[model samples]
Target: MRKNFAVIGLGRFGGSICRTLSDEGFEVLAIDKNEERVNAYAMIASHAAVGDTTDEAVLKSLGIRNFDHVIVAIGDDIQSSILTTLILKELGVNHITVKAQNDYHEKVLVKIGADKVVHPERDMGRRIANNMASSSVLDYLELSDEHSIVEIVANSKISGHTIIDLDIRKKYGLNIVAIKRGMDIIVSPKANEDIRANDVLIVIGTDEDIDRFERKVMQ
Candidate 1:
């Protein structure tokens, strides 16, 4: 069954989520206090409403608890964000993901039982920095502060060598989880599998280990 989703506060973050989820065929209910904002997504979402989610009565009236997941992407108003999250928790919403304005806001959301807290701006900055830092690193996904999964483009230096020959696990303490060659993806590539120039290596390891791999093998 397709899971239902409700997004509160139709700002950039919430509006993006609503549009993407709707495009992906998920039933999304977009809510915001701003009438104009609500009207903007009316044709995009499964349903869009103009109402303040901070009020328990408003939430209950909208059947917010019936949705499988709720995303609180309230911007600027930290107090309203917290209040909305608390009401959702009290209403027994199954899964709640919230966008935190800062470290302090993240802590408060976590304490209030938000299932997940995302710092979009901080994360995007890290991703952009990583891509700019290395010509070989095509993309970066932060698994944790200390660990990450990176997609590194294979260069001539690393090409024509098999996984075992490179000794990545022993030398860099990293795992080449997948190799993307053109449109094909090889998952858990065998140790003897040969790597070619331009193959996108999907690797997972500690940040330091990945950096070491980049400096040694990618260069």
Candidate 2:
């Protein structure tokens, strides 16, 4: 389903989200206090305007609270970001997501009523480190603080075993979303499908569960 989005700030982080959302066919209103930045996104965003999100009057004028979702992607200026979020909450916005620079910023954003607080820089670093740590691990994405979706190389443990034989869900709590075997790709693989060493498993579950499964089944 298509949704309306509003992104505040037009720096690197905010600019990237704006472009991606626009490309994905979302109606985006890109806002920034900087005239140059606003103009830069004008050609891309459904609507672009120079406005101070920290100011309630400006936010009210733009009807920002009515958007399906609002992203507080303001950079560096933590004070403005927090103030803007507070106002958005007061105005009864349904959802608000804020970008935090550090742990402290993340805590403050959560306390100030941001529906979701994200630390993109720290999270990306974790992902890169996880991929480097294991040979079988292709990529890692944090589903939450504890859960993750991992792309892992299939090994010899259950090369021809079906899901029934593996007892995957009940025993391991891991769900295999897809499989990439050599040049072939399988989406929504069935329970009857046989696993083979060298196939990549795109599995989703808690980090601990994935590790356990990798040891008992994929090993």
Q: Cα deviation in Å at residue 87, candidate 2?
A: 0.5
lDDT of 1 by residue, 5-45 (tens): 89898887778677656754578899999999999999999
Best by lDDT: 1
CA lDDT of each prediction against the hidden true structure: 0.86, 0.81
RMSD of each: 12.1, 12.3
Off by over 4 Å in 2: 123-219
Q: Report backbone clashes per prediction.
A: 0, 0
Q: Candidate 1: give its CA RMSD in angstroms.
A: 12.1
Across 6-81, the per-residue lDDT of candidate 2 in tens digits comes to 9998888788678756754568899999999999999999999999898899999999877988888899999998
Q: List the residue pairs that clash in candidate 1.
A: none
Instruction: Summing lDDT over every window of 10 consecutive residues in candidate 1, give the lowest-scoring window.
Output: 124-133
